[model samples]
Target chain A: MRLPRVEDIEKRIPRPEDFTARSRGPATTARVGTALGIAFGICFLTGLWSHFQYSSPGWLPIGPNPAWLYRVTQGTHVATGIASVPLLLVKLWSVYPRFFLRPPKARRDQLLDVLERASIGVLVAAAIFQLTSGLLNIVQWYPWEFSFRRTHEAVAWVAIGALLVHIAVKLPVIREGLGASVEDETPVHSDGPSRRAVLRGVTVASGLALVLTVGQTVPFLRKVSVFGVRDGGGPQDLPVNRTARAAGATRAASDPAFVLQLKAGGRSMSLTRDELAKLPQRTHRLPIACVEGWSRNAVWTGVAVQDLIALVGAPSGSTVIVRSMQTRGAFRTSELPGDFVDDPRTLLALELNGEPLSLDHGYPCRIIAPNRPGVLQTKWVRELEVRT
Target chain B: MRLVRGLLLLTGLGFGLWGVWLMRDFTSEQLVSMGTFLAGGVLLHDAVIAPVTVLLGVVAARLLPGRTRSVAAIAFLVWATLTVAFVNVLSGQGGKPDNDTVLHRPYGLSWVVMTALIAAIAATVAYRRRRIAGPPRSR
Candidate 1:
């Protein structure tokens, strides 16, 4: 089918030059885009670190020594993502006129232009996906079947990749825009905010967006982060990912027959809650930092994970599967890596904040270790099967 | 600079394609879900959001006095930009039936506070701009 000529279709769409607003210039776009670039860069790096926690490439050892590492990293990731919402929108508003860019008459320029536009399409789509899906994930809402983590990771790369290419393609324009004044033809009787005022508004609005929702991570800011999914409030003064009732472990956890079993190298040992408590109880201050980016420090008191494994004759630094009696959910059984278990601070916690573990906070027993994801803490822990 | 730009472009395409390749095993449903949001975002912004923004600017310019129009436009820009992001969480779908602590805060009230604060700030800034300039200036 013969398509309409480029000039024929151009009549229906406004050309980039037709946008005459003094504030809607490349300078405003470049400034907002620069801030957005930094936000995305920080968010991507921190998100990659959060991803590495689950699947470490072994280039860096995710040590348990620094209990606050993931807390800070994931907190920054979520906070930065939140802040970028307004930044991205404002940037798009400034750059929207460019979407109507007319094709060049030169064939070579047209080809390059098409390629650049395609790359921009990819960037915009991927960015919108990342921000929207991330927000949904914060609320634990999964409207689709594909894995959130996997798709989120894959699309993040796409966004960053296209973003970098966009920078390359626009480098000359960006340089020129940044050097020039935002005001075109000495302002000439404008109606809305000046280019400078718009930039300031964008910055202030984005900062407000961030400060309002960052309380999930910043302890002192908890009261103000009403939009934060996890409010740093739960049983025993720490957020709980899963309740005993939700995990279907309430009956098993509260039963008088509850005993923690240890198995390693053809040897087996079981100890009741009282028996486990009597074996050199130790207290450690550790934060239950979650992947969703909420964390709280608590005084966890119980037998050390290394000590519990020793009863089954497992050597120190043994890898173990800490299985929870809440058998129905994901991460019900978490692998405690050799290095993590070797640390004396790793504990099968029985007391939280000087009180017995609340029924919702993993009743009889739970795994409390340094720098571990909250989901992998394996609440209502029943069996410690040493693998190494 | 040309060499750097070329290298960046190539590396970017490589990474972007790799991300696309990762979804080779996704079911049709998954792909559709992904595409819906991806394309929907662009369409929503370009077709709906942009046009409304332009229309509002034109309407405000024609109908309202200059000062109120300018301040309102900026405040709307700030509020709408943020509201689009806050819509999902505000839907209350995030709340868990058994767990009251999860998403337990009054987000609706928070949004109201956010709007009031943004309007107040915008008005204050506009008032100061007028005060400092010492005369009513054209936008």
Candidate 2:
């Protein structure tokens, strides 16, 4: 089938000015664009940090101290992303009128117009993908087969690139749009909502969105953040993302014969659950900060990672490869960076909040390290291999 | 300004192309599926969401009485916010096995309370505005 010409498409589609409820205009778009620009910038930077933390190169050293650094950055990343949802909607709506604008008649101008539209299509598609998929990820819902991390990072590059291009192309219009007050723009419908009212509504909507969901990261807002997926409350007042049964580690973890093995300097030593408890138990209060952004601090009681390394005659700054009892999963085995292993607070935790660990909370033993993502803190840990 | 714009455009193009290149490892099926999702998102927002929002705004503007329109709009926004916020809960997908604390709060009650509070505030503001204006003009 032959596609319709631009003129024919324009003829069928209603012009933005013709819509009775069209109160948004260039000024509104610019204002919303500014807000979105800031939000996207923050989200991008934080996202980059998170990605680097997950896939750090040997030369890139993420400091071990300031245990809350990753927590705040990842939290900001998710919060800004969620807040951008409303801003993006309003910004897109404000500019929706341009979709029906007649293409330029001049050959060069027409080519430029086509190029601009194509860029916009890319930008819009990428932005929507990043936001929606991000929200799904936080909720632990994967509807697609592609890896979320790689796809998200790749799409982020596309979105930001398109955003910069759009801004560059629209620079003149943006300046003009923002120069005048929003009220100066004439409303298409005199009896409809005023531009000021629309602005107010947008602000309210965006604020509500932020307030309703940000409590997952901001502890004070927990009660009001009804949309927060993680309530910051679980066994020992710490939320559990994956249970032992869910990870297929229940049987392996709870087996009476379960013994945690440590290998370092070609010497292997195994400790039973009771023997682990008999070892000098230390308590450290650290937060289990998940990449999804919810975090809660708990008093974790167990043996220090350094002490475990020392038991096997390993060097002071040796990296440890932690293997979990789970038969299969992406994070069933994790490597603790040398810095994390050396940190005094890093523990192979046996209890939480002064009680024995619950089955869902890595019952027998788990790795808990400072400034580390929750996924890296391997649960139901069964083996530790040291690398000098 | 022109130089900056040019630089930005070129940089943007470079990043976009690199992003596309990175997806070379993805299977054709995955690419097609992801493309569909991306396009569907844009269409959903532009076609369904924007039009519905405009229609609601128009209906509220033309039909509702003075001051009540603002109240209605605020009420509608609050309702929409609550709905979007609790979508998973409403759809019964928020719960997890052996984990009551995840999405455990009474979201329906919270929405009601929150909406009522918003409506109450809007009414109060409207009442105060009327009081300040001395009364509605005898139209």
Candidate 3:
């Protein structure tokens, strides 16, 4: 095959204006870019926060103080991601003509143009991965075999980085484009909608996306959010992500010998289901927030974690590890920070919504802490080990 | 500005390379699957979603009357895009066990109601505009 010369290639490629109904220009691109920039920024920051909460590095102490911190952040992460779907589509549409633009003739400009196109490819690919995987994750659906957490987090860095680079490169054009009025002398396709009309359509589309889906996180809008994955309704008006049967804890959870064991300060204690109920119980109207961006505020009644630690003669503020009865899964054991151990609201929850905890809802015993991720809540808890 | 752009470009390239390096730990099959997903995502958006949207818009512009063209197109686009994005949830594929809370609503009916509401609002706006203009001007 004879290789085509650069000039020949340039001659063969069509200009952006040749095929489109309107003159594809920088104005719409800048407008859409601004919206996408904000959305991507929110998604990246919130996603990073969610990642940190799981990893819990030593330097960045993720305190359980705010009580609703993870709930709000993770919810915002998923919501922003969902909102980006329309924005991204519009953004890509606005720039679709650029893909067909004739390559620059100058050697320097050609190299730069190639670099710019490559960066865009990376940005688009990473953005799609992040959004699709995230949406799938919220619905508890995994189409790919790769671990969602690592891949999602890793690609997020790629997306945000490419986004920053894109912003940097396009800053001048963006400034000029935005400065021009929406109705300014941008060429339009004789048959197509005006720029203002297109903008209006995009705005309506974005708003519709938010309104239809945000109710998964926002309490008031739950009724209207038909597309919401989590409707905040479950066994006791709270949704369950992992069921007892799914976790393979049904047998052990229902066994009469099932007792919550505590070991701390060289002392050990065991309490039956009935005995646990007799302890001083407090009620908390805290929300069970999941990392998947659904949450419900339910009345949880149980003994404070502090009180439970005291039963084994452990000092207050001691770090404790809660173990679930499920013999399998990564979250079978979870460590509570010293501060969380000291928080009075942190509980060994025995009841949810005024009823005994359903087996799938972590019956017998479970840990409920303020501002903790749902996975860290550690349902079907059987053992508590206090760490020095 | 030039310096900032250069610095950002370098940083972005660095981060992207690091991400690629991280993927080295995965098996070749996982890497290949990841690549397929990444490429498929771009293709889906570019080849299917954007083109379809543009085609729909063009058809609507050509077919719909002038006064209602923009309004109808906007409403239709909103509803259609949402339906596609939410097909899994709408079709009850998101349902799990006895948990009626996860994707429990009648999405098809809700979409109808929402579309009806949008149409009503658009009609009202058009009617008011017509009234304010004191009927269509003589051609």
Candidate 4:
């Protein structure tokens, strides 16, 4: 069939220049895009690390929870995600206009547009599910009747995959957009807000988010944190009998007495199970946040691993290894980096909710470090080794 | 400019502070669970789905003309549906969280082998096509 001639189509179409813009600015949407990109990257990495824990254990170990290490990494991952909400909204607002504008120069650009549009659809869906799901997880709420573990796992894959596609499609455009600005004597103009102004707004909002998150997480400002307390509540969150995690049963065996081996910098020392019980213990209530986006808080009591390591003569800046009675033919080890071991609040927790550790809860011994994810905490402790 | 920097700095600082606060109270149980879930998902997805998806994509691409996008979308839908089903199966036990139901095994051996095979084949086909097409006309 013969197609309509260009002259014939002109009657139905608006002028070409009407759809074209000489330049685009760093609108609020653009800034939000940048922020979303960055936040997504952080969440992606953390999520990936969380994934790696299952695929390749010890690849990136955070000290067990209630430990400073676990809390920080896990919390940061959540905080950045929370902050991304505003950032994503603004970025979408800025970039939404581009959808209406005519395609830019090049066939390659057209193809990229196709890829990017699809990616945007996927990204938006994934982000909404991931973010809201994650936030709900923090508060220990599950609105959906679906399986949290499976749905979380599936959504995470979709989200990450979409994210990768989005980045692949947008990278060049982002680079060009940024590069073009530096090259132009006078920056390009568009109908939206100026790039610099939008960026300024993002910068302020992000800063405020940080402050608020910190205020909420920091122990000193717990009373002041607008974001609320870090804990997600208590034991109801933990599985009743999640199996003796390799060494979980050992914790009970050590009840009358427990030994916590402290190793650092290639040196190792042992504390009698009873002696470990005798040491001064610290207890703090904090939330255990997972990358899967679930969180729980409980009263944790234990000798600070940092303190115990010091007592056993482990030097500062030594990597610590926490081993559980739970083993998979040598796959049951978790590493605590030297830096994390030195954090003042790192702990060798033995009690939960002011009581002795339950057998299922890594009884007798477990490592609780702050700001670290839950996976890094080794339960049913048998040995602690420190290395530089 | 300062405003932007201030914002970024503030954001970073906020992360830093939140991190520090989390550092204050540490528990081993939560970490173990988090690690388990995270690792399980990554391993299953990377090792299983990635390879299978790529294989399906390649096969579909070869069979259907101008249907690469559709094939990819199909692959994703299939994967999601399977995951939902698998996770639900796992979730049948008493009081398991919704997240743990579907296991997207890491796309491991499958991912590596499939990706390598797909890349090699694609490269070979492209090379042959270029050779046949010969020199291009100047635009």
Chain B only: TM-score of model 1: 0.83
What tens digits encode model 4's per-residue C-alpha lDDT throughout A66-181? Answer: 34443455556766776675565445434434544556689999887775575566556556666655655544455454444445445565565565555444555665565555
lDDT of 3 by residue, B70-100 (tens): 5665566566656655755655554456445
Candidate 4 deviant stretches above 4 angstroms: A1-31, A53-67, A101-115, A145-154, A180-195, A229-388, B1-139
Chain A TM-scores in order: 0.94, 0.95, 0.95, 0.53
The lDDT, on a scale of 0 to 1, for candidate 4 is 0.53
lDDT per residue as tens, model 1, A206-290: 8777877888888899887777787888878887777777789888988999988899978998899989888999999998888
Question: What's the TM-score of each model vs. the native?
Answer: 0.94, 0.92, 0.91, 0.44
Give candidate 1's iRMS in Å, 1 decimal: 1.4
* Separate DockQ for every predicted complex: 0.68, 0.48, 0.47, 0.02
Chain A of model 1 scored by TM-score: 0.94
lDDT of each model, Cα atoms only?
A: 0.84, 0.81, 0.81, 0.53
Residue A246's C-alpha lDDT in candidate 2? 74
Ranking by DockQ: 1, 2, 3, 4
- Which ranges in model 3 have alpha carbons more than 4 Å from their true place? A1-14, A19-24, A186-188, B65-68, B115-139
Model 1: colliding residue pairs? none
How much of the true A–B contact set does each candidate keep? 0.66, 0.44, 0.46, 0.00
DockQ, structure candidate 1: 0.68
* After superposition, candidate 1 runs with Cα above 4 Å error: A1-12, A182-185, B124-139
Candidate 2: tens digits of C-alpha lDDT, residues A1-388:
8899987876887775666543567777888899998899898889989888886777888857798888889988887887777678767867877787877899999999999999999999999899888877776777787888888988898999999999999999889878868674554344445566667777887788788878887889988788778778887778998888778999998898999999986799999999999999999988888888777778999999989989989976888999998876689899888888888799999999999998889979999887888888899999999976
Candidate 3: pairs in clash: A21-A189, A22-A189
Ranking by lDDT: 1, 2, 3, 4
* TM-score, chain A, candidate 3: 0.95
